[model samples]
Target: MERLKLDYNILVIDDDKELCALIKQSVTKENISAEHCYSGADGLILLEKNDYHLIVLDVMMPGMDGFQTMKKIRKQSSIPILMLTSKNDSMSKVHGLRSGADDYLTKPFDMEELIARIISLIRRYTRFNFVDNHSQPLTYKGLTIDFDSRSVITQNGTFELPRKEFDLLLFCAKNQGRILTKQQIYEEVWGESYVYDDSNIMAIISRLRKKIEPDSGTPFYIQTVKGIGYRFNKEV
Candidate 1:
């Protein structure tokens, strides 16, 4: 039984040879192919040479860190990117998101969780491109969504969004002012028919808030409904 979807190639740019081998082995089980690069410059060169479905990059690298490489990549491609960082590093996570990473996973993460994130990111990216091909108007928070580009911009600045956050944001924006239950959101944004552990959705929402909200603690874009789900309070 071929388990992996085998739809796209994944490029992993990291200095850790063992981790890269682990990821390549794990991802290959899903029928997906992976390429590895130990240097930032090498990853850039590979990016120029091939088309990758997703990029899993490590934050702490020798010559050029993941952030710098991603920054450079953003100047060319909007491909989905997942960043790997040290555990509980809030500042690095923030900086990674701000630098156009699609998702960030801490080091020593569960392999299952990493695979789930990759799938979710790819699904969201595909959906956004679908909407873009149809020329849909995706607007929220006085910002316009560009499905083709996978980016959001305001008068203050423009930022690239990682896969799931972009889908979550567009989902909420498309349903502005309507409170959506967690299950509904999980099904839609995650593209999963089965129920997921709601904690993942909450984390995704939190990530989205931190990226778009002026203040994540006092968020105006995505608001919780206590026992319910969440609502995109565009009016707020």
Candidate 2:
């Protein structure tokens, strides 16, 4: 099968000049344009001057690290970020995710896996941004989801969710009353095949329930289907 050519620019922030060059060369083959900077500070400056579809950030850098850079970027934009780190510990991965990274890849990673993750992040981001004129806002009970604007509203007030959260919610809302498996949700929302354990999906669902459910302890909208997966209750 012929691969679809992607026309997107990505910013690579890493002090390792060799790796940056390699990543640029690799992604260019897939029709992805990449720009690189040697430092986090320089990366921030470039980000201010140009628009990028996604970011490939190295965790360990001189002065400001990837976590610090990610925090700064999160203050201004919700652009998808893929963090590259040498640390393989679970805590480091958790920290990266909590610091606004969309995905984390440890060093000495397979180039193909890195490319796959990058494409998945970009595709997921693009899918959410693409608006359909024919689709209408979905309202159930007091919760309202505006697909065109990519906003969610509840009885509490309007909430602006992170990219993954919004995508997961939209998927569930669209398939209300249907039992969605973990693999199904992961593949659909993440834009990749499910490989990791169920913890990732479980965490996202827990977070989503907190945001939309009146009582997350007793989630009314998103119901657990026991060991199977979840079902967005259309009858809520």
**Model 2 agreement with the true structure over 1-236: per-residue lDDT tens digits:** 12336688999999999999999999988888999998999999999999999999999999999999999998898688999999989889767765567678899999988888788767656654553335667667979888766777887678788788888888776555555677768987889988968888889889878878889999898898775577788465
Q: Which candidate is the best by TM-score?
A: 2
lDDT per residue (tens digit) for residues 7-32 in model 1: 66899999999999999999888767
Q: How accurate is candidate 1 locally (lDDT)?
A: 0.78
In candidate 1, position 235 carries an lDDT of 62
What TM-score does each of the candidates earn? 0.59, 0.61
Model 1 spans > 4 angstroms off: 1-6, 136-236
Please report, in order, the local distance difference test score of every candidate based on alpha carbons: 0.78, 0.82
> How many residue pairs clash (N, CA or C atoms closer than 3 angstroms) in each of the candidate models, in the order given?
3, 0
